[model samples]
Every structure is written in C-alpha cells, then in structure tokens.
Target: MAGDLYPDHGVTGTENRQYNREQRAGKHEADAALYKSHQCEQTPHPGSWRRHDQRTQGPLVAGYGIYTQGQEILLTFSFCSSLVSGYVITYFPLRGRSETIRLILSDQGAKWTEEEVQFTDWFTANCEHKKQAVFGQLPKFKDGDFVLYQSNSILRYLGRKYGIAGGSNQESALIDMVNDGVEDLRMKLVRVLFYEPEKGTEKYEADLPDQFSAFERILSQNSNGTRFVVGDQISYADYNLLDILHVHLALFPACLASFPLLTAFSDRISSRPKLMEYLKSEARKNRPIVPKK
Candidate 1:
C-alpha cells in the first residue's frame, strides 16, 4: 500500500512545525474572539478551556511550540483554505477532499496530534518544489520518519492501518472513486471562481449557477437517503464535502442560497455532534484578529 501511494504535500519537518504554530495561534485567537462575542463555545466541552491572546505568548516561536515532539501526523488548516469550498473539499476531508482518513483516525481512536498552518505561506515557500513531490502538495501526513502528502493516500494509509479501508478490494476502489470525483468537481469549481476575478461580479455570478448545479446533480445522484456520501458507513468523502460546504456557506452565501439540497446537506453535516462540538470549542478558543483593509 505504501509503495502504491505517494505523498502529495510533503515538506520538511521544520517547515511543518513553523506552519503549525502560526495556525494554532491564529485559530486560538479566532476562538477567543468568537467566545467573547458569544458567537460560539468550545468543543470537548470543558470548563478548563480558557481563551487568551496568542500575541501574549510573545514574539512567535519559530517551530514546534505546542505539538508533542514524537511520532505524530500534522494536518494544516488555514483561512485561505477555508475561504474556498473547492480547496477545502479537495484537501480537508471534513470540508471536501475525503474524510476517509479523518473518520478512520477518529474511529480507530488514534490519539494523533493536529496542527493548523496558513495555506498561503506554506504554498509560497514550497511552490518551487511541488512538482518534485509525489502527492504534489499538502494536507500531508507524517508518521515517525515517513511523510505522506496526498490526502487520498493519507486516508488509505490510515484506513489500512486501522483496518477500515474496506472489507474487500471492490469497496476500497469505490471509496477512491468517490474521493476522486469530489476532487474533480471541487477543482472545476475553483477554476471557475479564481481564474478570472477581474471580470467582476457579473462573471462571478454567471459562473456560479452552472458550478452549483453540477454539485446538486452529483449530490442527488450519490444520495441513497443516507447522510454519508458513500456506502452505509461514513467515509472521508462526507467530511470533505462538509468542510467545503461550510466554507461555501460562510464565504459565498449567494452561491449556497441557490442550491437548497447543498444548503441542507451542509447544515446537516455541520450539526453532527462531534463537529458541532469542535466548532464551538474552536470559536471560543480562537479570537478573530481582524486585519486592516
């Protein structure tokens, strides 16, 4: 399995650490502000979760500030990634790429650590070497000395390791198809949105109809009257779609309002007990630091 899989978003351990710290501080600040504003609460629901200013930590440490320095996997989350549904869905399974790995990791009860990193800085710093890596870019996974980049490959590794990839080869292949299909749709949507912003709202407005229509069609076809994207059980695909949907709803309300099924789906997924908890916790812990316009 390892031989067939490639790491899509591999970066040096040092770089990953730096990126994670920044992300953590940003998320923490955002949560803190959200809590203060009464917008939300923290997840895992504990009285001990206190909100604080990240800047107070003083002059931002370079690397490995909070993460346990041991065998662990780093998942980078960023505002840029969260801004677009396509990118969120393509990489972060909860938002889009495929939540298979996330689900497997959660199900296996793996106690892996998570780290958020800014998408822009990470990409800019490593853009020159993207083609050299197997997975192309991030949402990379590092276990011990080995690093796996591609989101799908990471999911498969986690599934197989945790005995959740599937009961048979046919099932595993199906999972891959669903995951790849979501990726394809998300990429197309992103291209339409980002390719020509200079054309103004007219162009942006014109493109959304078709892209959103396609998303609705795909969701309708894949729906079997179940909340999960594929099969009887929840997989990575569901999480990927959910993450993307949340971002879309948050950033592009106009686009989301046009599609009722997508809107409902997004709401349903986000309200899941675990995710809701996470969101609440995230909101309370990370105070939003508004940047100057």
Candidate 2:
C-alpha cells in the first residue's frame, strides 16, 4: 500500500514509478543496468526490511519479486505495524496456535488482520460433506496474494523471512529443537485441556517442573545462561514457546516460581522495547489468550 517497492528500501513511490517509466522508455541504460545488477540485499532483521544492489545476486525489480506483483501483493518489506498490507489470518476466536503466529507479527511491529470463527461454523465450512477448505483446518493465513496453512509451517516461513531463525545454521537447529520441545509439552497440556478440562489446572501444575525445566535448560545453554532460548535473540521458537508458557502462567499463577531463570526470561521477552506497546495495547488485549469455553 505504501509504494511499489519496500517503503524504506530505496526510492519513494513517485521515484519508483519514474524509474519504472524510465526503464520502460529505454532512456536510462546506466540506471537500468544498475537496477539489474545492483545486488539487492535483504537482511535477516526484525521490524523492517532492507534491500539494495551490491553487484551480486538478489531478486531485483526487473529480475525478481516485490515489483513483479506490485500493489497486488506486499512481497517486499515495509516498516509498518505488520509486514504487509491486507494480511488476514482466519481462525477460531481463541489464542491457540494462531495466536503464537499473531504474536510473532505483532512483536515485529507488523500490520495484519484476524478473522475469528466459531467451531460450529468452521465445521460447517469444512465438513467432509461440504468440503469448503482444501485442508479443512482453521488458522488459514493470507498475505497479499500468498495464502498459507498450518501453524508451524507459517511460523517457520515467517521466521526464515524475518530473520527470526537467529541468522545461522546452528541457531536455526536450536530453534527447531526448542520448537519441538515446546510442541511436545503443549500436546501434554492439550491432552488435559481436551479430555480433562476439569483437571487442566492441576495437570498443568503437575507438569510444570519437567516440561518448563527443559526450556529453562535450553535458555541456560544459549548466550551463557541469559535470555531467550536460542542465540541470545528472539526466534520463531521463542514466540511459540512463549505462547505455551503464557498458557501455563494463566492456568497456574505460580508456574514459574521454581524456575527463576525462566521467570526473568519471560519478563524480558514480554517487555521487549519495540513490542511492549503492542503487547499491552487495546487491540492485543481484546484477543484473550484462552477464549471462554
């Protein structure tokens, strides 16, 4: 919505249009050659996207994306509240896995939208008889012309795109490890919630030490026992694991009493400078982590 290229990448909307016109007119061969071979670079960064030509390989406006789609899709980086415009994530009116993905975008100071559906309505939409959705699943995410399903897949894509994978192979591996660990623990909690809602509280409290301690150990190993679970920075795993930990905190107020390191780590992530405002904003507050059952 902001412009043809990334808002803060290089040229303005007017400038980009002029450049495109010039290129089309075959008037600026020097600029055109530069644009083609400028070696545009996109960094693994948070809250913003950077692209430029360094005379190497990059998806340029002429050779690659972000321009081919134009305003029809926000394929380039924009420094808005969310990464792209007209982004929509369809899900039930609850936190669940969708919320973690939502939190990742929110933490990155991106702009997006959410669509909450009721279970009965979703069932009707995707029943075997009706077969409205290809996957018959909730949390279908749409960004510009791109549509994505599956919570983990979406998070992984965002992580890789937004530089939340910690910028290295080892860090990425750690992220994957932490993510699997969180999922394992989450399934345990989910089992209780689905089959034994009455014991959700007791079950979470009982599983706190073993389940949460694993995370504490993970955090301890990364960055010399400092904050975050991977490479001393926020990764896809952190957002995901935080979602699970937040659920536990909600279920058991004293869940982190014994895990001092985790307590501090949670506090640190929850209070991220760029993300704090959105986390505490009215918009975020409106979406409760656990919708009323």
C-alpha RMSD by candidate, in order = 15.9, 9.1
Ten-residue stretch with the least lDDT total in model 1: 55-64
**Residues 197-221, model 1: lDDT tens digits:** 4654456556767756755665676
Please report the TM-score between candidate 1 and the true structure.
0.49
Q: For each candidate, what TM-score against the reference? A: 0.49, 0.71
What lDDT does the true structure give each of the candidates? Answer: 0.47, 0.65
- Report the Cα lDDT for candidate 2: 0.65
Top-scoring candidate (TM-score)? 2
lDDT digits (tens) for residues 161-241 of candidate 2: 667877788788889888888888888777777767776466567757987778888777867557678776678898888
lDDT of 1 at 208: 64
Model 1, residue 226: C-alpha shift (Å): 3.2
